[model samples]
Target: MSADTQMLSEFVFIYTPLPTKEAAEEMAEALVAGRLAVCVNIYPGVTSVYEWKGAVQKEAEVVAFIKTTRKLAPDAIAAARLRHPYEVPAFLVLPIESGNEDYVAWARGQAKA
Candidate 1:
């Protein structure tokens, strides 16, 4: 990729799951309010199956996709963890490898490290 492409790729989408829609909304608002994320999209009615404490667990969850710049990712994660109710909240930071340049620029501008 060219330098320009790299510059445009300096963003990430953080995936975080919460037990309820309310929790997801709260986290989303907190991140946006704190300027850690440009926007957060919340999706409810997700069924998650995983292992915890040597037992399998299944539960419904709401997922949040947080959009922000790479520079603000760490801060966003920290803020999410502080407010997340889960003992070990699941956080997956997916790099924005490519996208509309305008959206990338706008998201980066909205996020503050």
Candidate 2:
């Protein structure tokens, strides 16, 4: 889909990893309260392996699955970035091509509010 088409689509899932569970929870609460996302699911005990500053690194993290409509993805991303501890946080947004219609509608309604 085109970028605009994707942005106007019904669903988008934002993935971000925080340094700690508490940080993840705080960010999730702030995003939901600000209406940037409908729900933020935190999965702790995540082991992340990546390269940083020309060196391979491994670290423990809490991954946040932020559920929201495409219309609110940008705002959700911005909110996450502001609260993220990493210098360059992982703010990945994936489009949901298909899902339960009612749930999608509910998510959209939640984000819109």
Candidate 1 lDDT over 1-113, as tens digits, reads: 87467855677889999999988888899999999999999998899999999999999999999988888888999999998999999889998777777876687678774
- Can you give the TM-score per candidate against the true fold? 0.90, 0.86
lDDT of each: 0.87, 0.85
Please name the candidate that would achieve the greatest TM-score relative to the true structure. 1
Candidate 1 positional error at 22, Å:
0.6
The 10-residue segment of model 2 with minimum total lDDT is: 2-11
lDDT value, candidate 2, whole model? 0.85
Clash count, candidate 2: 0
Q: Could you tell me the lDDT of residue 54 within candidate 1?
A: 100
Writing each residue's lDDT as its tens digit, candidate 2 over 1-113 gives 86445544767889999899999999999999998888999999999999999999999998999988777888888888888888988888888777665776677677865
